[model samples]
Target: MNSAVSFFYFLSFLTILSAVMVVVSRNPIHSVLYLILTFFTLSGHYILLNAQFLAAVNIIVYAGAIMVLFLFVIMFLNMKQDQEESKTNLTKIAATIVGGTVFVILFGAYRKTAIEPFNPQTYDSQIGMIESLGHMLFRDYLLPFELASILLLVAMVGAVLLGKREIGERHF
Candidate 1:
């Protein structure tokens, strides 16, 4: 296979492995780490698809900011690893069967799509550049962008309110 195809397969394997580890790992921290790896692999895929801006945003927003917040929350909760698990063999078998079935279905769908190779001439290379992105954001998506910021501010206020200790509460 050519390097592009080989690289695609390698990234696909890494992304799948990390995603599975994220769900299967017992420790929350390990899961978070796996999630970060998954995000990185996805960013690599975005880069391969010539979406450099998306790759940068994915790394900065999800891998950096969101994962840090997740780590902080996990630490704040003071979670410790425990050995209390009760999954039976039957449950494991069923879950595996279901997961395998879904994977097969998705793979079949992907095969049917028969995606074509990238063509630079047919695509607008400038679309992914910062200037084009900024123009699109301000001209077309300005209202939605401003609303999203407002929603985020509201969420921050809500989080602060929820985290605030009650005046009448007693601590041990």
Candidate 2:
């Protein structure tokens, strides 16, 4: 196998492991931290796929900005450590049955799908640098881009409003 394929497999493993950790971790803060690690590993996979611009954006938007917000919220909340609870025998049996059913469904779907192997030669020779991405974003996706900015602005305002403490009722 080529280095690219090996690197892809490594990144896939890292991303999946971290994602599982994010879901299974008891502490909310630890889950968020593991989710950040998963995002970073996904960015590495994007880079390996020659989508450099997407990788950079993923790092900046997910690993850098969003994770900072998540950490800030976690710290502000001052969350306590979670206690482990033992599952009942009946509950464990039901969970195992459900999990096995889902796994079998997914395995059957995978087997039914026709997956073509990757061909490196099919990759476009043009570089997906920031400049090229910017050009495409401006030319093709300008409206959606501006809408996303507006959506983010609204979310920021909502977060501030929700976090603000009300002292007294306002009089006209």
Candidate 3:
């Protein structure tokens, strides 16, 4: 087929492979690295969708900062004792059932979704631009935006509290 379609498939393959590797890798550091690769490939898909802002944010926020934080936690935890415990068969079966149920629910929901065709006349090319995003966040969605920020602040404080060790607590 076309080069763009080929590139899209290649990126999709990369994303899936890295995602699977993230789950399958024995080493936490390697898993984090694979997760980073998955995020990068997802960013490629965003670029293919012409969502440049989303692509950049995915790369910068997910692949960059979040992955670094994950790697740091993985390294700092030194979870050798935890690794000795293998998953029970019941736990694995439960996880599989839950995962399958969620997948079926999402698939059925999306299958019934009515996708509207693209309309050039009503479309705004600048909809995904940073300026438009700023206006939308500050004007139309100000309250939700501020609330999310406050929630993030609370979560950050909680993370800091959990990071420090407490008396009679293991890795708390």
Candidate 4:
């Protein structure tokens, strides 16, 4: 098999394994770590598909912001309990180095791959940019976009209602 296929399989395996670990892990921190790994793998898949913007957004939004949100919730829930274990600095540094190495490898692979030249007859150069994305979303997919916003608004309202405390409940 070609190197591209092999790398694709490797990333797919890592994504699946990390996703499963996110569910199976007993420790909240461990599950969050696995979930972050899963996001990184998904970003790799987006890169392989030539969607660099989506890959960056996945890393920034999902792996960065959303992971922080998850960690925040976990820490909030565990505030009453003492942390049982902490890995050594050496372990943390090793993990960082390994993750960086994997990122570099994937970037190198992406760089070495040839991009298909665009044909003006069949391709729009503005295909993946933010402006085009916004235009298409607002124009062609307006109904679906509005429906998604309404759905999110409903969910947010439901969450607020569910989390609302009773009138006489003690704040603590």
Local distance difference test, each candidate? 0.90, 0.88, 0.89, 0.88
lDDT tens digits by residue: candidate 3, 20-131: 9998887888999999999889988987877788889999899889889999999998877467566889889999999899999999999999999999998887777778
- TM-score of every model versus the real structure: 0.70, 0.65, 0.79, 0.56
Model 2 segments beyond 4 Å from truth?
A: 76-78, 81-122, 156-172
Clashes by residue pair, model 3? none
Residue 75 of model 4, lDDT score:
82
Residues 112-152 of candidate 4: C-alpha lDDT, one tens digit per residue: 99988877698765566667778889999999999999999
When sorted by TM-score, best at the front, the candidate numbers are 3, 1, 2, 4
lDDT of 2 by residue, 73-121 (tens): 9889876665434567888899999989999999999999998786779
Once fitted onto the true fold, the runs of candidate 4 whose alpha carbons sit more than 4 angstroms away are 79-132, 153-172
**Candidate 4, pairs of clashing residues:** none
Give the candidate number with the greatest lDDT.
1
lDDT of 1 by residue, 1-172 (tens): 9998899999999999999999989888899999999999999998887778989999999988999999989878766666445567988999999999999999999989967787868877668767888999999999999999999999999999999899999888
Clashing pairs in 2: none
Model 2 residue 15 CA deviation (Å) reads 1.0
Better of 2 and 4 by TM-score: 2
TM-score-best of 1 and 4: 1
